[model samples]
Target: MKRILPLLLTLVMAQPLGAHPHVFIDTGLTLAFGPEGRLQRVKVIWIYDAFYSLLITQDMDLDQDGDGLLNPDEKAQLTGFDMQWVEGFNGDLVITQEGQELALSGPQDVTATFVEGQIVTTHWRDVTQDTAGSGTYEVTPYDASYYTAYEVTLPVEILGADQCRSRIAMPDITADLDALRQELFALDRQAQPEDAGLPNIGAKFADKVVVTCASS
Candidate 1:
């Protein structure tokens, strides 16, 4: 109602209204694997408003590097739209540890809760879509370190795990878009008019990035 009142008054006051709400999205995920590439730990961090929360996360290895480092072949395959590499979870996933390999079948969902208050979670469930998007990473047993990169896209939505299906409304989409354009089209701060620099009309927003995530 607080938000709605402002909108209604805008119409009555004949004031210019902005069409947007802000949803600052920040997410973090951590997963651990055994010496021989066995699933272990999962951690997730999701931030919205001025508050953020986290959950245990699960990951499917798309490719493994033998040299204990991110290899060129692996990077090349994950690059662009027409690239293919030794992607795991595309169909099957194998975790081998202590001279034994275990196969995990089907979609893996990370069940967790989101607390609105500072103490005792205000909500609880397994919000699977929070882990939406494709993630790339490799582990190095020699050093016990891993590296990863991911892109987030729409279509794949995050709803609390075990919770009933629901719809979410966001206002940040517009603000972010506008901010992006102005930032990208922004003129060089150090450039002078005599330098034939870019026009001072300000930056323009480029295209939005949309990523897809599939689990099986």
Candidate 2:
């Protein structure tokens, strides 16, 4: 006789995870600049939601002792698991300078730890080149698919410079959502279901840190 998969397996294979948020994260960013006022790197800190943390802790199977705490081995395993993004993810962090998108290298100094029943990861990424030119710069962190919601939890910081001030601006997504609803309402019933859904406008809901420098 041939082995058979279970009914739940068949259902899950037919309908994979949808484009809805399943995880949430609290993010903090620190902008680092050289002594010459050239932007150098960005440090990111992500704290997983308590419920997600519980899931991660259980999934990793690191707590061999069943002590309700992450052992050293488990900590080591989580140090860079999430930071290691695939070819195109970029960890959902986007930065633009003077209306041009800046290319950032991979993350370095990746680390993870369990704190207050939450998993926290920290890493830093360097820009491909010095972006010291006088212009407006913005940094936004968001997951394009909205599979995870990222919220800014720390005040924006400008390191190694006193002339530049950073302010966090949260984009309003109400208009975008309302527009999408209206579009769906007006869609023809004969149209395919996939053709009448809202667009992936996750970026519209991201919070940005705008950095302004003193005029020369």
What is the TM-score of each predicted model, taking all chains together?
Answer: 0.22, 0.79
Expressed as tens digits, the lDDT of each residue in 12-38 for candidate 2 is: 234434334446789898888887777
Highest-scoring model, lDDT? 2
Question: How well does candidate 2 match the true structure in TM-score terms?
Answer: 0.79
lDDT of 1 at 145: 8
Q: After superposition, how far is residue 102 of candidate 2 from its true place, in Å?
A: 0.6
Put down candidate 1 lDDT per residue, 1-216, tens digits, no spaces. Answer: 011233333442342312211112333333433333323433333333321111111011223432323245533332221111233422111122222333333323323232342101111122122222222222111100000111121232322222212222232437765664344334343333224332321112111122122222
Model 1 segments more than 4 A misplaced? 1-21, 37-43, 50-109, 116-180, 183-216
Best by TM-score: 2
lDDT of each: 0.25, 0.71
